[model samples]
Target: MTRSTTDEAAVPPLPSPKERRRLREAKSLSEKEVAAAVGVTRATVRSWETGRASPRGRKRALYAKLIAPEPAVKPPAVKPSVVKPPAVTPEAGAAAVPEAAAAAVPEAPDLPVAPPVPEAPPAAPPADPPPAPAPAPNSDTRSGAEAPDERRVSPAEAFDELYARTAPGLVRQTYLLTGRRALARESVERAFELAWQRWPEVAVDRDPAGWVRAAAYEYAMSPWHRLRRTHRQPDAPPTEPGKRALFDALLDLPPAYRRTLLLYDGVGLDLPETAAETEASTPAAAGRLMTARAAVAERLPELADAAPAEQSALLHDRIGGLARAEHVPVPRPARAVRTGSENKARLWTRAAVAGVALLIAVTGLTLHTAPTHYEQPISPPERVGGVPPRGGPQKLTAQDLKLQKSLSEQLAHGPERLVPQLE
Candidate 1:
């Protein structure tokens, strides 16, 4: 007879607990073991196999895949069995085998012979355990693989990329603040160099660029830079007659106030960020900006009289023109002086030479005044006990005589005896 074909061929059935147990056993696993692998209880697996319940959702899909038989290669089809058996009553069927065999039926392999059924049904169902907790975010599973593209790049590489992208803007910002192209370049380059050194730490910081800018501003305004500036005058060429008034006005302000104004108004940083960058309190930074505004107002009387847009344009032009002007580069301090070790060595050599000169002078004076003989002249000794010319004992003072008398009197009296037996 031709084998019956059905819609089941197109849509596979989910595995029953018994089927799962059989498959698991064929693959060397028990019902409870398969249940544990699928993160469900043995009872749930059992219910599914017995046709008492059905597996659902992702779990059902997993169950179907686990127990589905491999497709057969082109093998000869087998004929159905010809033997027929008498229909038994339900009670008779129940009494065919022991209860244990029924329970163990789920674990049986798909062998030719069927196991006998039990007289009694299996025991009451086991209690349902609590549901498992949800998996944490981004947890990988056994079958689920991570995508290659999601891997992170190294911090150094990332910092290098960011530096390349932002360096020009950062240089422009520095130029606006200092109005000196060389100083701007030096400040921006130094800041980036320091950032590159600590890229790992800086990469993790919330605002790495801001941190760099702050560091650059601090380095530019340091006492060392101030001292260097004091020795060498700025070489910025005289501003043209049109911009001369504005240039002088800006130069007149202290560097701290100038930085605050430039960062806020010129570079377009908000007050708080400008304050933080300049290491100034917000109020102080605001006051500096106000003072800068007033100074600009005095010099560019047109700004006070012009519309707001005109005033903005005028200020920008003045600051931008100053930045474009050729200013004398602050020469990198001479390498020997910058290193400091050479100066320190020279100082020590001078001190050593002075110490040696002092020592020699003292020694020479001592040698020049050296005594011919160390022994003092021996004067004739005073007579003692009428002995002739012997060295006499030291003379006693009046106070010594009194002390001697008291000691002599006390000794002469013999130590006062303690009173015999206290009464």
Candidate 2:
């Protein structure tokens, strides 16, 4: 026998997705069991449980029965009670006697006493109609229906989401830090680049936005900015005098104090949080915050009248306004950042390798050219201690030369005499 459409329509409604899951878990049953009982795929059961899809027709009835089964024990029948109008005497009626007074009247002995009416049994409740699903505690009205399933997103997608969500605000904030639109954009972009490079750590961070913000703040507030010619001159001040004064005051304060003030006031961080981010003690952060506030108050005549708390609030608004007023460039796309990070990593790797190779070559050259053995150095010649200074054929040379000349003259004249003597 086939079931009629009416029978299908009479099937009880399914509970909410969360309720379905809860029911299955309460019974110590898994999705597989529900799927097997309902003759559907485990995935379908999961979708039903997650509220991604609702079962229909036969599947719906089967699922409702399996997950939200009727209680085995029937509730005890209850007798119905009816309240009758209090009987009143004509005299009481004319006097507008109260119901309590009429009910209090005792019946006369001669009057026939009416018997109490027996209560009728209540009609049987619809056979095993599952109890109406109780509303989920602390759940929103919309939660009565299945909530949209939360899908697992890839890391790149998650990174892109974080970047898109925070990049614009970060740009504005960095603008506040540096006061230069170009630098602000650059700082935010560079921060994202760094985040992409370390996405594993960044993605797992409790506050990814804070991580990027800190990086951007550090870049924007770097002292090395002073060396950049573009950063030497201040950006065009805000057109409004209030904003201009606020901006100047911020720039005038030291970077640490300005950052502390910004985090505590502008970003709404608590003192301890500000200190943690700034790497300072809470008292130090508080001191910087106070000092910064005082400096700003000194610069702005308007702020001078306000109390410290009011001054901080005013500064926050003004800083926010100042940041928003500047037109910072849109943040670079996550893909672009990831690509840039990869390129940068590759470049650094090559550079490190080249540096190592160059160092090795230099060491090898030094070893090749270095002297192998030690050599003694020659000493300059010196005169003998006992030897008299040699007088070259000097004055004595004149006498000797004269004697030789005389002898030579005698030999030239007496050559024939010497020959004869020799003969």
Candidate closest to the true structure, highest TM-score: 2
The digit string of per-residue lDDT tens for model 1 on 1-423 reads: 333444443345654333344454456555666687677998887667544678776677666776767676887766654332234445554346556544544443544434344444543444566698987657774366666657768765676666666666666556544555566667766776667656666776556766677667766555565456632344353558656676667767788887777777666677756655564445678898878877778887777787645665677666766555634343232232223434555688999999999999999999999987888889988756855675879899999999999997775665768877876
Off by over 4 Å in 1: 1-147, 175-181, 229-231, 306-314, 317-423
Q: State TM-scores per candidate.
A: 0.40, 0.56
State residue 228's C-alpha deviation in candidate 2, in Å: 2.1
Give the C-alpha miss distance for residue 270 in model 1, angstroms: 1.5
**Alpha-carbon lDDT of model 2:** 0.77
Residue 355 lDDT in candidate 1 = 100
Q: List the residue pairs that clash in candidate 1.
A: 16-49, 17-48, 17-49, 18-49
Best by lDDT: 2
